[model samples]
Target: MTVYDNCHLGHARAMMAFDILARYLRFQNYKVNFIRNITDIDDKIIERANENKETIDALTGRTIASMQEDFAMLGLELPTHEPRATDHIEGMIKMIGTLIDKGHAYHSAGGDVFFAVRTFPEYGKLSNKNIDDLNPGSRIAEDESKKDPLDFVLWKSAKPNEPSWDSPWGPGRPGWHIECSVMSLENLGKHFDIHGGGPDLLFPHHENEIAQSECASDHKFANYWMHSGLLKINGEKMSKSLGNFAMLKDLFVSYHPEVIRYYLISSHYKSSLNFDSDSLDQARSALTRLYQAASLVPLQESDLHEDSVKGFIDSMNDDLNTPEALSILFGLAKSINSTQDAQDQSMYASTMKELGKVLGLLNDSSEAFLQYGADLTDEEISQKIEERNQARNNKDFLKADQIRDELVSQGILLDDSSDGTSWKKS
Candidate 1:
């Protein structure tokens, strides 16, 4: 199984969703080979590069690097192979040649090659659409050259000053749909366990892949098809035109990446996740409580007691039900917080850590996470502490308690030990 990341480039939600699935599959003792293809050569990439006066290589390279950083921050294991569309041009050419030889594709006089949808017997199985009901889009213009209007392009004829590659027809590039078909076949063979992407790609992109690959290989394409729902902001769909699309870098400036990951995973993968500052803030507070409980327990190197942690594994194994898994984790956290016994706390903490490994959250110290921003200066905190001490010395307990309360509100917890007073982030 593999999750495509074209639209969710900077967002870690897509990767986290698949991580939960992959971990669950591993827990079930299945050897899954996942392959996620990077569309390095797309019309959007070229258009964005031109608008920014940058080259396509520079744009894709920078975005790919940022993607890697985001993936690391989200704790996603790398896929078996990260194939680039441009890197597999040779494979695409061979596949296209096979389709032409099999009489499933034809070339136009303008050097553009298109797939003959009527030639394929199982053209609409994946999409469950009849050939007569298919309509033409802006891309499928009224061309007398095409045998059928439903036939999509396999290769686009390159114009002057555009990216071009030598093919049997002429100098042109591969279409958007053909890249995935060729890349997946080249890396994972004709049939694979699963194929995934955003819900929007289900119509043309994935549908066309099914048509081309099956017609060429005379075998199935993928065993299962998985898709993630679109992200929304508040009640509106996130889009560049609305100026409501939040970039991952900008969101990480004030919020921790883990908080964002938690917010994204809180809902089911197939459900629409509404983004808002309040949602992230709630996630932050929830994680803080979990981490605080984790901090109270000591770290253990012992293996997890499966009988005790069976609920967590069960929730995760049943179609990767992360929301239920989170509820189990929260229950464990509550148990740890309510315990007064030292040995029980230790056992609960160890169990919490192992279960957290599956969810890919709560893997950090409470102190470090609370002190994420260097906004508060040491001298300022010292001055506040001095004022509070002065209040206490004057027997004005009310003022001292107020000052301490203010500090705690800022995520600074105060503790008075036999040695002296100490402060830590809550």
Candidate 2:
């Protein structure tokens, strides 16, 4: 669960993929110590900070806070540990020293250090790529001072006014890939349960990490490697250059949080999710039915009934099949809506809650959520109630009906009882 917020809270597709894997691991009773590292001191961070006329600390801090807020809105739990690259300089330096001692890294004349990719026998095992076949492209250039063109930098020579740390190599900072190696080793030990990120990291970033960690510790880095698919906008890769990238904060203003969450989770973890306003609207409408059904049923504690909830659990267990699980939930919602018996409705309600506990959806009532942005004052609602009561008492059915219609249009539902009239948000 190592996420790099290179642009922001990351693409929604990446977050959904992590959420599914985390939920599935927890369901299977695994003590998963998930750690998502933050590359707070990257080249991009410095560039963005400079463009905004802000300090590096301020840029990273604000983006991290916004990322946490997005995670909360999606109902995602925080990672066990969040290590920032700037905060773990000591740990990174220690690991780099170990690599240098093990002859896996070398120092250049200009005070820059690079990893010796040729020294590692299984260099491209994780990515299943051959060093001979790797097209260096623009990533590798002719720096005659270096041993090999393919070898990437382990420590960079700092420039004036840029962030730097004191190291044996020189007064420089750790490379982008080294940060994860150090953070993972410090937080989750040399060998951890799982390592995950976007599919794009499988190449240079993750491959380089393997080279550094295994060479330093002489042990496996992660038992399992998982990666989520990239997000596209309308069948095209999202990029700032193309002007197709959508900001998470901008989208949040127009769409409900649950709607966006549903859209992200509807597709499989390893599949690309093409984001659009229409698709999100469809997800919102689909989830609205579940919320509407849940609203009709009275609230009750979840009851354990494995037999009835097995479909939902089985779908989730099969590599977190959220689409299938949602289908099962829809079927249950239909059952609740079509049934009339009081006892059956109560049983259905309990079953729905039990299923919702696993899916992390349909847990909130429609009434409660629809009241998210109401401008009406409490006194106004009370006055309307009083007027409705007065109309009913005076036997003016037409006037009472008009008032009730106005309330309904404003997302309020009124139920008339013999004793009085009760109201709730529609």
Candidate 3:
């Protein structure tokens, strides 16, 4: 499950990664129950709400809607269940009670309840770090009332003018870690096939979830863990202080959402993807190649190459190696372009589109994808092509060349054939 607080491209990478996995699993005939949770209430939500001078619901609601829109823009499949942290408060309260009863948690003199990390012997198993190796006071939040510095809070005491909910201990909210644990367990039960999130969450956030859930239920947590690597701006980590962070909406103004999705999926999910103009240009160029080849062949309802589909499924099965899968796609596109046989071209195009659909690419018409984000419409380009043809027919070679050059300047490439003229965005 993923969390949301001003969701960015980094978050989109993780979402797309799991989305592809879910899609592939369903394609493989698995009954996949994908769940992505929204962290509606948290320290960040409170801080942002107070700063914006708005109610928590108002801020969270707006942000959540915007996030959903962004996900759809990137072609992400909606999850099976999307639970908000606030909606599962009763389950959180009950889980915290179980932890306290199980001696894995305690209420401090202050209203907060803290988890006893030392009691959980396998606390650092996921991260593979020893408790003794941890810096004496490193990574632990500053809270003086806790018995130990590493003991994280399960429930946070409400401060003045903060959002509060009814609880046995007092009016407070669950801590960040407890929210995911209760939500996942209540919805997916004690055991699920797999759990996934961003790499950063694996340490404290997911680590804490495992401890709390396992201790509370005396059952194992998720069988497998999947974490997508972080996204960087240029060559460095994206942070507000660095001034290199790019928001999703801002990127959409400069590039098509499909282009951004292509760039994000060009690399392996476990590898860091550096965002740069050149990388985006490469993605656009590559997608242009696929669309150009797609345009050469007529749209067929069914025509597939068994070998190509097998290669695609193999690459996807091998840990979802999308980069390799794309290589197969590009190779098929090359064959489609080189082939003169109409039947073979159609078969190649069908195989390419079928494989690309697995990765959510090439679904748009060639004209649509090629002309997207262009300054001129198809009719405008066609009219310009007609004028150029008339100029050529009148033996005005210079005028025809000039018209073609003008269209080229506008990012349109015109191809003159005996049949007529066809155009595409450069």
Query: Which candidate has the top score in lDDT?
Result: 3
Q: Which candidate, 2 or 3, would have the higher lDDT against the true structure?
A: 3
For every candidate structure, what is the RMSD over all alpha carbons to the true structure, in angstroms? 3.4, 3.7, 2.2
**lDDT minimum window of 10 residues, candidate 1:** 1-10
List model 3 lDDT by residue over 24-68, tens digit each.
898888998888888888877788788888899998888888898
Q: Using lDDT as the measure, name the better of candidate 1 and candidate 3.
A: 3
lDDT of 3: 0.86
The best-first sequence of candidates by lDDT reads 3, 1, 2
- Per-candidate TM vs. native? 0.88, 0.86, 0.93
Off by over 4 Å in 3: 1-6, 239-242, 376-403
Instruction: Put down candidate 1 lDDT per residue, 1-426, tens digits, no spaces.
Output: 121222342245566677777777776789978777888876677777778787777778877887777677667878888898999998888888999999999997767899998998777778797877777765457777787888888888888657889988888999888999988998899998888876767887898999999988999999999877677887776766577777766666666777777788788887878877688789888887788788887776655546548988787767677788888878878888897987777777788777777777767777677655434565666677888889989999999999999888876777766755656554
What TM-score does candidate 3 reach? 0.93
Candidate 2 weakest lDDT stretch, 10 residues: 1-10
Candidate 2 per-residue lDDT, tens place, 1-426, comes to: 222233422365776678767766787688878787888887777777888888888877777887888777777767888888888889888887888888988888767888889889898999999988887656656666678888888898898878898888778888888998998999999888788888878998999999999998999998989888777877876766577887767666555677777777787877877776688668867877888788887886645445557877788778778888888778878888999976677777778766666656665667555443334555676688889889988999899889988887876667778867666544
Model 1, which residues run further than 4 Å from truth?
A: 1-11, 138-144, 302-308, 377-426
Rank all candidate structures by their TM-score, best first, as comma-separated numbers.
3, 1, 2
